[model samples]
Target chain A: MTQPDKGPVRPRHNVKIVRKNNRMEIPSSLDYLPKVDQFVESKLKKLRIKKDQLVDIAISVSEIVTNAVMHGNKNDLGKKVKINVEASPSQVEVIVEDEGTGFDPSSVECRLDPESLLKEAGRGILIVDSLMDKVEILCGPGKGTKVKIVKLLR
Target chain B: MKLSSRDVGDVMVLEPKGKIMGGPDATVLHDKLHEFIDQDKKKVVIDLAKVDWMNSTGLGILISGLTTLRNNGGELKLANVTDKIQSLLTITKLITVFEAHDSVDDAVASFSK
Candidate 1:
């Protein structure tokens, strides 16, 4: 929403429909992570988010989106991933939703300790949490995972 | 990710360009790092100034290199860490783990110390 008075809060489902405004729809593919960063960075710049802050938010969003595609959706082309961004006066919220079984964040062992440092996986979620102001993960037996990441605007 | 390696004196400097995302890119760095280890070249310096950015996957690669070298009685160090990557290390508390230098020459010099 270009209007300053009327906020830009909208739901985007289809990939085609996301092209309407500030929203971007990404496929359930990890290969698209960089593209997602490019889109988010440009939009954040338009919102006057600083370069450092932009990188932090973009990196956080990428981690969440990558997890949704690789872990939740399992990179299934049949499944879909929707990313919606809503910037209010106070903060900016980006939601990454996937049509797959959800994961428990607590179950993940980040292994930041000395022994686990050499390992490859498990740092995605931890880094996201540290970078974002707020990270909310919602999932159920039948319901897919929805990750809401919010960054305070400065 | 693209990798370029050259020998500076006895040390090996591997310059990886582009984002070190997961998938084939991860394997490339892993294999190259190990390749040097296999050759008994334990002293290594990874120049990160040219790199655009790296996710956890990139950090993992660095960890893998560090440990592998330590096991071989060699060591791995980082040079020219960009602001973006430095922040990632700081947030993850990895800034405490890796020794970073302002330039490649500095990192290479640290190996002697």
Candidate 2:
């Protein structure tokens, strides 16, 4: 029987190209934010996402990744942050998973009152939600905190 | 972030460039605002045309600047806010707190009245 021909080298994520539905891991570093930006930009550039849309998506991704690195990983550096992207014709989905113990989202305060306007900080997640189409966090159990964000393509 | 300032009439215009992440970047903006406050220079405008983006730490600095200026019997305002930064402000509900203008000229002109 003739052996099936092997194809040319195919680019893969991480050290190994795990098939779709498989997961990849990344170091939780602030510097890694730029790398994430490059990866997302390269993946989405061909789709003709508008410049404004790209920026919105990119910024939202950065905010969530930063949270994963700082809050979830606690800047441990030794711990890892995992990001998975799944792109479909109609929408793009991204999952950011951090190993740190998760906290209640409801507890994250938003001082939106007129008196609290001059105060700084506590707005990263709020901005991410406003920019992204949908954001859902799944935490608890052996699975770490997973922040899934989606953006429409069309 | 690199911050440079100049006097626009009686008001001071602060120009900050690059990202305003936490750490040293936060200190510079805060210290400068305090320096101005000590000098009793109350009217101020932060020209944000060049800032790429800032996190919560950066937002804190702006808040400190505004509050410090106001306590000193002066005022602080923002000018030329980019979409990225503006979105952050809106999300934080800081949009309600700050008095922002479309341009530095408008910010400067507002101080006259």
Candidate 3:
């Protein structure tokens, strides 16, 4: 975040924050993605994580947020996406929840497949799993999909 | 994200500055690619030099452009691929698909040959 870090002079209301447990919520649409990126990056910057690693985490979270808005909620303006960030001295964790019909993570086709390689979609989970140290997906029909990812700071 | 395009000879060079996360921003680039395709501007190069980073959604946009151009009997290439994005293409094996160059000039030159 050395260069990408936002100065404190930026606007405060870009994203809503709750002191309760470090969480944020936005409508289930793609419009708020930049806010989510800034919100997550600012938190990671405070942790003093490496710049490259910070970018990896930021990109992964962005991908998940997109999936939530598009597939989970079907871009329904009425739905919402919740993001939770938790950090320790050694690692950081991000949790994303979307109000949409749940999907089976395993059911997703392999993006590495030759046929799907040039295909324009279906690489979100792959990218997230490759970048984050650990990724866990929990979902059931009508229950919504919760994706939790962890990255080691050390 | 902001996108600007110009013609370098017959090739269209699109320079997008900022993150390409999926959303309205992504849509604009996607739409612009097809817009050029409709106009029969086939030879293309996407200069990623100024882009800070992009997630899979960004990668998807590139594929969309690549495929669309191919279907139209045209071609698309990438230039100044950033390190973070290069790793992504490698990991996803898309490195085998898109033709990427070290510089925009080289990418444009390849279009003529």
Instruction: Give the winner by lDDT.
Output: 3
What are the models' TM-scores?
0.81, 0.74, 0.90
Q: Which stretches of candidate 3 lie over 4 Å from their true place?
A: A1-21
User: What DockQ do the predictions score, one after another?
Assistant: 0.21, 0.17, 0.37
> Candidate 1, what DockQ?
0.21
Q: Residue A152 error for model 1, in Å?
A: 1.2
Q: Kindly report the docking quality category of candidate 2.
A: incorrect
- Candidate 3, residue B75: Cα displacement in angstroms equals 0.8
Give residue A130's error in model 1 in angstroms.
1.8
- Chain A TM-score for each of the predictions: 0.82, 0.79, 0.84
Q: After superposing candidate 2 on the true structure, give the runs of residues whose Cα lies further than 4 Å from its correct spot.
A: A1-32, A141-143, B1-3, B18-42, B52-57
Q: What is model 2's DockQ versus the real complex?
A: 0.17
DockQ class, candidate 3:
acceptable
CA lDDT, candidate 1, residue A124: 85
Name the lDDT of candidate 2. Answer: 0.76
